[model samples]
Target: MAASQAVQAKLSFLFKAANTQFASCPELSNFYLHQFQKTADHANVPLADAVQRLCCARCGALFVAGINCKVRINSIDASKRRKTPGRCRNRVRITCHACRHPTVTNGSTTTLLKAVASPGLSVSVAPPVDVPTGKKTKKKKLDLQAMLNQKKAPSPSSSSFGLDDFLSSL
Candidate 1:
């Protein structure tokens, strides 16, 4: 058991060293990173496996700053986050040079909200369900005057959704 743990720790060290050195000497860093990957795969070490996921599996490049990857911060504030333009959400966009792909991840605020809202804490977090992250989405023009002039429809006594009706019956 101890021997396996030591091997896992050594692999983690190699991963960290490779990450730091990747920007300066990609070839050497890749050598070490690849070594760690191969070892982790053979041993099926969970810690090293998780670390490997942070790198481009194909290129063995570390997801470090302007090196082989880039992360962009997108933050949405709480006041403006519930509806309208204000639905609060935070995202981190990760782009890998090897894959030529961008992946979005939850940012600090989303993580904090998750921590608070987990069943143990019982805090409620309402995240917007349909906001699109695709580049093709056209930005809607906001006209405050037109919005203020719109009429408010009266609420129905019964739920309009079949799912809601089913839950209500229960």
Candidate 2:
């Protein structure tokens, strides 16, 4: 337990240092962030949700909203989500600008909405269905000959226009 506390203190210090140095020297900040992760891993300590949200999983870079990352809220349709057992109701997507890697974190709708609606943070809602990420659809074979032979609607003739007769009567 003493070792865990030491590791926690070290992690907090590293995280703060990383954030402080990030604006002036990003490389050094990234180093600190990497060290933070390494220390946590070595101590077998799990990172808190608050800490995890501000770090990039790919490059170990500090995530600053709108500066180094883009944060968006993805809401799943209730009916669709219920059909899929493993899917989350609401997902918060944080895309790291440095590596262009997107990390998705699932949470309650109210909490995610509150986080996104906070002042100074830009919020964008994703489409209900992400079509591109799903499986590719098979193209159906078209019967050109059958389509060409199909009967078409008759075109209206000039005699069909009774406006001239109507004007003459008026």
Overall lDDT per candidate, in order of appearance = 0.67, 0.79
lDDT of 2 by residue, 44-162 (tens): 78777888888888789898888889999988888877775565687799999989989888757455577778899868888698454323332222344445555243335645636
Give the local distance difference test score of model 1: 0.67
- Off by more than 4 A, model 2: 1-5, 83-89, 110-170
Off by over 4 Å in 1: 1-6, 48-54, 74-88, 110-170
Instruction: Give a tens-digit lDDT track for model 1, residues 18-68.
Output: 878876888778778778877777776655434644776666666776867
Evaluate model 1: give its TM-score: 0.45
Clash tally, candidates in order: 5, 0
- Cα deviation of 169 in candidate 2 (Å)? 70
The predictions' CA RMSDs to the true structure, in order, are: 21.5, 15.7
